[model samples]
Structures are given as C-alpha cells and as structure tokens.
Target: MSDIDTYKQQGFGNSTGFGARPALLIVDLQVAFTDPQHLGGGNILAALNNTKSLLAVARQCGIPVAHSRNVFDSVDASVWCVKVKSLKDLTETAPASQIVEQVAPVPGECIVRKTKPSAFFETPLADWLHQKNVDTVIVAGCTTSGCVRASVVDCISHNFRTVVARDGVGDRALGPHEASLFDMAQKYADVLSCAEIAAHLRGALPG
Candidate 1:
C-alpha cells in the first residue's frame, strides 16, 4: 500500500463529523510564507482566498474565530532555532513573520502567537475553546505539511471534531500538500472545500 493508504490502514485518521459548537482556527499565513522570496514563502494564494470565504461564513454564523502566528523572541534563540535550519533574520518583530495584510486578523478576533507548530502547545487556545463549548474546529491556513498538519493532529488528539478546509490550506510542495490532506482526512479531520464548510455552518445556524 502507498504511504497514505498504509496510514489509513493503521487507523491514523477518523471520520469528519462536525459538531454543534464549532470554531475556526487559522494557522500561520504570515508574510514570510506569502512572499515568494522569503524563507517561508509558498504558493498559498488559493488557500488564502478560500480561507477568506470561511472567515465570512464563520462571522455570519456567530462562530468564534481564532488565529495563530509564529513569533520568536528577539534574544531567545531557543524558540525555533532547533526546528528551522535557516534561522537567520527571523525575529519576533520582523515584517516577514507578520500575518499577510490580505489575511490579517480583524479587531475582535482572538489571535494566538506561538513559538511552535502545534497551536495548542503552551497556548491558551485549548482552554479558550473548551470554555466556549467548542466541540468542532474548522481549520485553515498555510503549509499543509507543517503547521497546518500539526494543528490538525493536535486538535484530533485533544478530542475536538475537526474539519479541514481543503482549499483553505496550502503547502510549499504540491505532493506533500496533497498527501498531508489525504492523511489528515483519513485520520485527523474531515476534509472539505470552503463552500461546503460554509454551507454546513449556514445549516447549523438559525436565521
């Protein structure tokens, strides 16, 4: 069997059933990755557009929206030094590390900054979602094979119903992106397009 098939055979993923109390979590879509010349850059424009659609629907349905961005301390080399090989010029206040303007978090949204891939790692996001009674988490963002995938797995491990926006998440490499999405769908999340997710949200909310 192929790697994805092997993963599924081993029960790495689960079904994509959504819950009544759902929230949205957008992963790292920072300027560094959006810009083609940056260390974190990729072809994620399509994912960004789909994520925008998901954002509009979440707002219309009164669902809580959360976002995560990677920020390292200026003087702290322990943050991402071990993970990222090319770690030069990646400071907390660096313009490249900021979320891209097109996908910027709005005023009322809760934005979480982390020094790691998993959104819940040393973050208040889990408690925040639990307090809000969120049973389902609609996920979006950049680099499907990295932060996005890690967040999905963490969400599942935390026992949250997870829905992955297929078009709303992108990768630096097409092969890895597709493989990650398939693996996530088979194991961690229910993978769907932005429109399907919006429709599902619309159906759950009252007029």
Candidate 2:
C-alpha cells in the first residue's frame, strides 16, 4: 500500500472537516518574510497571491479574519532570536514587522502579535477566536515548514477544526514546502487548495 493508504489504515489521517463557523488565520506574511533581502524571505510571491485571493473570498463571505505577526520588542527578544538571528530584525518598530500590503488586514480583523512560532503562544488568539465563535480556522501563511506548521498543530490542539491552504502557505524551498504540507495533511490539518477552501466558504455562507 502507498504511504497515504498505510497512514489511513493506521488511523493517522482523519478529516475533522470544516466546522459551522470558520475564521481565516493568516500567519506571518510580513515584509521581512516576503522580501528576499530580509530574514525568512524567499520565493513566497505565489503564496501571497493565493492568500490574497482567499482573503477576498473570505471578506465577501463575511467570514471573520485574523492575522499573526512575529513581533519582538527589545526586552522581549527571548532565546528564539539567538537561534534565528534574523528574528532580531523583526522588532515591533521595524518596517519589516508590518504585514505585507498585498494581504493587509482591514478594519474589524484581529491582528495577533506573537513572539513564537505558534500564534497562540502567549497571545490572545484563542480568546479572540472564542469571542468570535470560531469553530474552524482556515490558515494561510509563509514558511510552511516552520511557523505555519507550528500554528496549525496548535489550532488543532485547541480543539478547532484546522484547514491549511496548500497554495497559500509556502517555504523558502519547494522540498520543505511540499514535505510540510504532506506532513500536516497526514497529522494536523486538512490540506486543500486556496480555490477549494474559498468555494467551500462561499457555499457555507448565508444566502
């Protein structure tokens, strides 16, 4: 049997499916990550475009939208910055810490500033989602193998249905991106294309 089939037989990959209420969670699509000159940058333009498309659909459907940024203040720069030196440049006042203009958060959207890989870490994301009655989270973001994966796992752990848009989340290299998507699909979240998720959201909305 193929690996996927074996995983299915082992009860590893099971669909939590989309829930009645869903929110779009865009994770770390900041200027530092989108611009190749800065740390965490690579060919993420395609992923950004896909995320923008998803954002448009979410807005039309009136789905609650939230964004996460990896922001570190001077005193709060923790050990994470030591391991990833580039993170030092992502201070709260830095321009690179801002969300990319292409997929900027609009009014009424929640922007969660985190100092770690998972958006929920020491952040009010869970509380915010609960306040909005968000039972499911549709995620899109950068560095699929890193922050994206970390956040998805946390979302599932928090008992929210998690969906990761394959095209909307990317990594610096294709190999890691593909691997992370497959891993998340088999273990954490439902991995689907941006178009597929958008279509589902469109249909799920009120008439």
Candidate 3:
C-alpha cells in the first residue's frame, strides 16, 4: 500500500472543512525568506507569487488578514539566535526582517512580529483573530517546513480551523516541502491548493 493508503486505513487525512469566518495569515514571507541571496532559495519565489492572488482575494472578501515577520532583537533574542546565527542579523530595523514588497501588508492588516517559528508563539495573533471572530485561517508563506508548519500547528492548537495553501508555501527543499504538506494534512490542517482556497474565499465552501 502507498503511504497515503496506509494513512487512510489508519483514519488520517480527513478534512476539517472551512468554517463561517476566515482569516488569511501570510507567514514570514519576508525578504530574508523570499530572496535567494539572504537565507532563501528553492521554490519560495513561486510560493510568493501564488500567494499574491490569494491575498488579493482576501482583501476583496473583507477577510481579516495578518502578516508575520521574523523580527530579531538583540536584548530579547530567543534561543533560535544561537541555533541559527543568521537570525541575529534580522534585527528590528534590518531590511531582511521586513516583509517583501511582493506581499507587503496594507493598513488595517495586523502585523505579527515574531522571533521564533510559530507566529502565535508569544504573539498576539490568537487574541487578534479572536477579536475579529475568525474561525478559520488560510495560511500562505515561505519555508513550508518551518514557520508555515509551526504556525499551522499552533493555529489548530488554538482551536481555529486551518487551511494551508499548497502552492502558497515553499521550503528550501522539495523533500521537506512535500513532507510537511502530507504530515500537516494527515494530522493538523486541510492542505488545499491556492485555486481551491480562492474558491472558498469567493463563497464556495461550508461557510
């Protein structure tokens, strides 16, 4: 049996269909994670491009949107600084920590500044989404095996239905990218394509 067949037999890979309200979280699509020159490479560029249309749909749908950035601070540096020394340079004022122009946040969208993998970790993301009464979150961003995955786990842990944009997230390697997608789909969130998600956003789903 194939891996998916085994997972199916084990009762995994079930869908957690979309809910009434949804929010869009573009996680860590910063310059540091998009441009191959600075800690970025692989298919991240394509992921960014895919997310642009999703983001546009979210804005047009009047969905609550938030963007995350890895903002490092010397005084408040987390354990990650030692593990990934490059994170040290992504200081509060560093351009690398800034969101890429291709997917920059506009006014009224929450800016979630994080230092670790999960956007909701020690961040106000949960509260913000709660206030918006958001029941679902559509995730789109880079380093699929990293921040995006972490955020998806945390998002479901927070009791929100989570949907991952397959084409909207990328990693430094295809292996981890595909692995993360499968793992997440089997255990944590609904891993759907950007087109399907855009359809849901356009009023085509359980909402």
Query: What are the per-model numbers of colliding residue pairs?
Result: 4, 0, 0
lDDT of 2 by residue, 83-128 (tens): 9988988888899999999999899999999999999888999999
The 0-to-1 C-alpha lDDT of every candidate, in the order given, reads 0.84, 0.91, 0.91
Q: Model 2, stretches more than 4 Å misplaced?
A: 40-43
Tens digit per residue, CA lDDT, model 3, 87-161: 888888898889999888999999988888999999999999999999999999978999999999999999999
TM-scores of all models?
Answer: 0.89, 0.96, 0.96
Query: What is the per-residue lDDT of model 1 for residues 1-207, given as tens digits with 9 covering 90 to 100?
Result: 787678768876567689889999999888777666665445487888789878988988989999998777755556366768444355677887788777788877778888778898889999989989999999999789988999988998999999999999987778899888887888788999999999989998875
Count: clashes, candidate 3: 0
RMSD of 2: 1.1
Where does candidate 3 clash, by residue pair? Answer: none
Rate residue 52 of model 1 by lDDT. Answer: 80
List of clashing residue pairs for candidate 2: none
lDDT for 90 in candidate 1 is 51
Which is superior by lDDT, 1 or 3? 3
True-vs-predicted CA distance for residue 93, candidate 2, Å: 1.7
Worst 10 residues of 2 by lDDT: 36-45
